[model samples]
Target: MTEILDTAVDFRATMGRLATGVSVITTRSGSTPVGMTASAVSALSLAPLQLLVCIGNHLYTRTAIAEHGRFAVNVLGEDGEALARNFAASKADKFAGVETVDDHGVPVLKDAIAAVVCDVAEALPGGDHTIFVGAVRHCTHRVDCRPLLHFAGGFGALRTPRHA
Candidate 1:
């Protein structure tokens, strides 16, 4: 029989088969912005409008986001790979030359597929990561482009619709 640990390992390895939307989880302390490249964001609630973003609990970004309480999730479109890289680096100057603005005093990236401003409502311990439950405070969208996606540890392009 497969042990519990072995089953969990297999499940995690197979999780890559499930594609997910890519996003950058961002926060600011004064004028300085901090962020992380995350493919782990997911919507959790609709009535109160909540979202969950998984973050490695040991990273600086986790602490920063916790301290800030207010943060934004920037939905990067297919062409925004560069932005993703910039934000994912450790304590890197992610804002250098990046087109962004303080959305109602919260850091929001410009030209995102969509930007969601939220406040940290709850934090739960998820196995290797922390699941941040944030309450949506504001949102903006541009329907012209499709969202960036990730699968099997690589970037993915949007699928085209088929003709009937």
Candidate 2:
């Protein structure tokens, strides 16, 4: 007989093995800017130029995105690990000393490797998280930057393997 190991801890551990690019999902709540570090972001479609981000239902940023109907995905570079850790926390002021600029009415990290401003197209429930589908309105990138990555519960930079 085969045994099925299905537990929250096990699920988390299993999923943590998958490496993903790090990004900060930013939006505005009223006049205040809000953001959260998210690895659950992904490009959803090409035709409509859409992307999706899964935000926790309890996150204030999630509520902000829904209310404002806009958000920006700031793709972090290698030097953004500290910023990522800060945003991941439940800090009252994540942007205290962080430099940002307004892009499409959303707060975008100035040092981001890339930024994608989007309008909320649809929001769906995903267990305890809200899956937000964004229609990309504007996008920008810095070719010189290398992306930061998250893997096995830690942060890292992408490394190309040397050919033999």
Candidate that would win on lDDT? 2
For residues 77-136, could you state the per-residue lDDT of candidate 1 as single tens digits? 999877887777765687888788888557788868999999999989998788899999
Among these predictions, the greatest TM-score belongs to 2
lDDT of 1 at 98: 79
State TM-scores per candidate. 0.87, 0.94
Q: What is residue 105's positional error in candidate 2, in angstroms?
A: 0.4
**Which whole-number lDDT from 0 to 100 does residue 86 have in model 1?**
77
Q: Against the true structure, candidate 1 has what lDDT?
A: 0.84
Regions of candidate 1 where Cα sits further than 4 Å from its true position: 1-12, 162-164
| Model 2 lDDT per residue over 1-164, tens place | 25565999888978998999999999999899999999999999999999999999998999999999999999999989999998999879999999999999999999899999999999999999999999999999998678999999999998764559
Q: All models: lDDT?
A: 0.84, 0.94
